[model samples]
Target chain A: MIAEKLVQTYKVSFDQNNQELALAGSMRPQRAAEMADCVKLLETSLASIRGTFYVNVKRLVRLNNVAFHSLAGALLKAAEERPDIKITIITSSVIGWSTKKFGTLTAKNPKIVVEEYDSEFYPGQAFLEEGGFVPVLRTQTKLTWKHERAILPRHGLEPGMTMADICCGIGDFAVLVAKEFSPSRIVALDHSKSSLAYARQVASEFDIGGIEYIYGDAAEMLLEDGQFDFVSCRHALQIFNKPEMIVNELVRICKPGGRVYVTNEKISQCLGEPRGPSIEWTYEQLSKLFADFDMDLEFGPKSYQALQRAGLEDLRIESFMVTNRDGDAQAFADMIMAWEEMFAGGMSEKRGDDAAFVEKFRRGFEDHIAAALHPGGYAGWPVWVASGRKPR
Target chain B: MDLGAGQTEAGEFTLLLEFDMDMAGFTSNWSYCDRLSTYFARMISHNRSDSLLYSNLFSSALNELLETVYRLHAPTGSFVCSVSRNGAKDRIALTIPVDTETEGFYRDAVVVLNGGDVSPRYHNALFSDGPLQPNIGLLELAVDYAACFSIEPADGNAIRLIAELTLEASAP
Candidate 1:
């Protein structure tokens, strides 16, 4: 029953995304009869969906048995009545009670199932999510921060602005921003729970507040709309299969006139003085190998086009080369060495590259590291930084 | 199900919140159960290991208890809701005006909750073909939240119902 003002207390929407019906907010109806409208809507929606109907309770923060029994009971009836359809309830682990409570419905029938969202949230980023890669991620952030700290101001980051670091690997950049520019709030989101846990631990160690490390998928983020003044997604777009989708999200969450900043790599453009030819061959091979996995290693220069397609205004596009000559030569070399280990020892193996190809790949990284450590040699990893303001 | 049981020691827990208002004003709208529980959950969950997760879990548990009282209690008297903490545990204490029928309902539900596992009962009640169970909230707190329930006589005709839980993944 709709109240006089509005029953804005909760919402149930038939998303039509993967046949998902999203339920959110506090749904504490007094009795089962009070949920008649919801039950009717759900039943009607079920008729049109495919063989599998998904109930996305990931954002459903609160639900009483009266409401649950009604909605879930309707799903159960659909399961028995329409045997062709499999009813799946998607619960978020973030809400502790969701999985356990919704899981009970599966017992009634095998066709009804409850699956937690976090387990499969991150797709195509498994190489970066390995436990060993965590330390390397921090080292990468440390090396990149030297360039970004200076580059951020030109991209429209200002003091007290609210920012979101999408795909915030380990969240060190967010901490850096919070300490330097003093954002009123920073929502640092990454898909890996392990990465987020480490980020929280680091923030706690630094005794810095205001950085909210959240676990989320960048493609279909749970973050609300137009809630941020500046949105910086660093070194992330290239990793995702669809960079434009993420750019659109960055624009969606940015307030009008607020800027969306991004950083991505042009892998083949990564240059080194010593063993230049070998490094070039390896990086070019690396770019193709990444393409095999749906990741875009050469998405740096394409950042301009991605933002433009997303319909952002006042585009500012530039590139920064994090070279060994800039700050810490050893640190930069350390980052290159870690990348070699991951690319050769980990991702290359997953790609089923032959011993000769992997050996050749390892040689290029070693040469880049050699260039970084060489006294007179120069090694550079170029990152493209781009920003566009959401039109007012 | 935390009504008419036994008293918790005064100094054993540190009080966090105390909201008092007339019962008629509180029960005038069913939405108050949701509003008050959410407000209390946010107020107390800031220091938890995962504040958003803790608040979401706590608000659900507290809303069930408040809804139970809203359904079964007398029409008039002061309603008191208090939250307290001792180490990792949080206690939601609701002192509500009760009639003989409502008093018996709480006492009986507590007995059923203590005698056996409430999970099967909760599921059965959840999907039962008959009319909805009035004590579903009690079984929910006991089973889903793993909350421990207790009750003691409060001032005048009121009974103090308490549900204590360790909702945090770890201490703050």
Candidate 2:
């Protein structure tokens, strides 16, 4: 073959402070000579670090033999030259080949360790997935679905459209969509293995088929470009520090004429009657609590601007308030109680909130639950849903 | 029938994918290896336990073989890559028009693949300086992916190269 040089689609950066060399994107250079500059940079990065040089390849999707050979040479050379230093390669299990490809190096040098960065990625959310959160999440989806089932059509979801649900949590919404919309195909992906396991169990238990639940990271997915007709990332943007990266991936995998949809919460806007002030104060504190974890409880309103900035056209945006009166009053009350435990019981303690502040925070959720069950009172949680079409 | 280099009749196999093009067309650009492997991997990996993971591995394994053929094939003939399945085993068979020397290279590669242990040889070839060992890709498939290799006679001036793989282990 002649003239087989592929386009340079990878980026290499050295963070001197952390002693990290980060590589991202597809790397399939035809010759080892093509990677000379990168190898030189790696050699230079190694000389300055005294110990534990980090190589982060979490977003590196495609790597070929020519490039791997060059990378291995430089790394193994560093091990030989610097006897005291340890080289750690951090790979993402989401990328699939990362751990396997990099793990091979450990056999050659004990100090050259490969670690898959997963399981503990979310700061305060692992506890929820470990046990109690799954049923609550399913109930949460049950409550939200009542509003979303109608709202989705307004946001460009229709029957027979190929769909993908990214960061799909317990995957209840994907199942709901599969049953209602009959999408040609539905690929539901989430980062949590336990959540995906539960999702698969739910799907299997119900004898539901045509929904493929996969384990993957939302920020960096291996899905092909323009594969889906409608792609949705619901209630995920609020939890991520940088939602734009996930937004870009959502838009990328969508066909040019297809649409990208997302849902996020404005937690501070949650309202309850009869002791409304107490509920208001607690939610405001809840926003601050999430802020400490690098999450935005106020991301719902910002969904419009996020989709607009993603270069999408024909945008549709709206907000829905799910109230106790929408369906079963007890279900809504139960959700608030779970939130009280999650936020006040778990997060508030982590932030070291004092007994006095914690008592007041707990009071607000209790009041919201009281309002939900009052028969005369109202409790509400607001969510914003947005969709934008990729330019044709 | 020479039956050399672990060569044997594959018996009947169910075809999953097959690509045939003029040798010049297939080898005109090297990106064909990447594109073809990626497409084939994606198309077939959907039903696997972990579709993304399976595709990533299958693509890598196939790309190495495709690259080897792209590098070492003869000047003119048809290049054929066919994929088949026998239960859990996935088979990749490539028919390449080769000269006597290239045919010898394939013969010896299968021998080295079936040869006792190839991990050290694979590592040595990977870190070696100057030109790569022409059989390095075969060794990697054997050592890294645990692929079983076989060779067979084809039409005039051509040889069939086959690799059998059981990539994913059973889930616990």
Which candidate number has the best TM-score? Answer: 1
Model 2 alpha-carbon drift over 4 Å, by segment: A1-9, A13-20, A43-53, A82-86, A224-227, A354-360, B1-13, B73-77, B86-88, B98-101, B155-157, B170-172
lDDT scores of the candidates, listed in order = 0.83, 0.86
TM-scores of all models? 0.87, 0.86
Query: Model 2 compared with the native: what TM-score?
Result: 0.86
lDDT of each residue in A156-208, candidate 2, tens digit only? 89999999999998889999999999999899988887888788788889988
Report the C-alpha lDDT of model 1 over A1-392, residue by residue, as the tens digit: 12243233578889776788888876888878989988988988998987888888887878987888887778888998997899889888766788988888888888999998776765567778878888777878888888889989999999999988888888888988998999987888777877878888888998977677765667766555687999989888998887878888888989998999998898998889988999899899889888988889999999998998898989999998889998789988888888888888888999898999899999999999999899889999999999999998
How many clashes (backbone atoms < 3 Å, residues ≥3 apart in a chain or on different chains) does model 1 have?
3
Q: What local lDDT does model 2 show for residue A311?
A: 96
Off by over 4 Å in 1: A1-26, A45-51, A82-85, A159-162, A205-210, A248-259, A304-315, A388-392, B1-18, B170-172
Candidate 1: TM-score?
A: 0.87
Please give the range of 10 consecutive residues that has the lowest summed lDDT in model 1 chain A.
A1-10
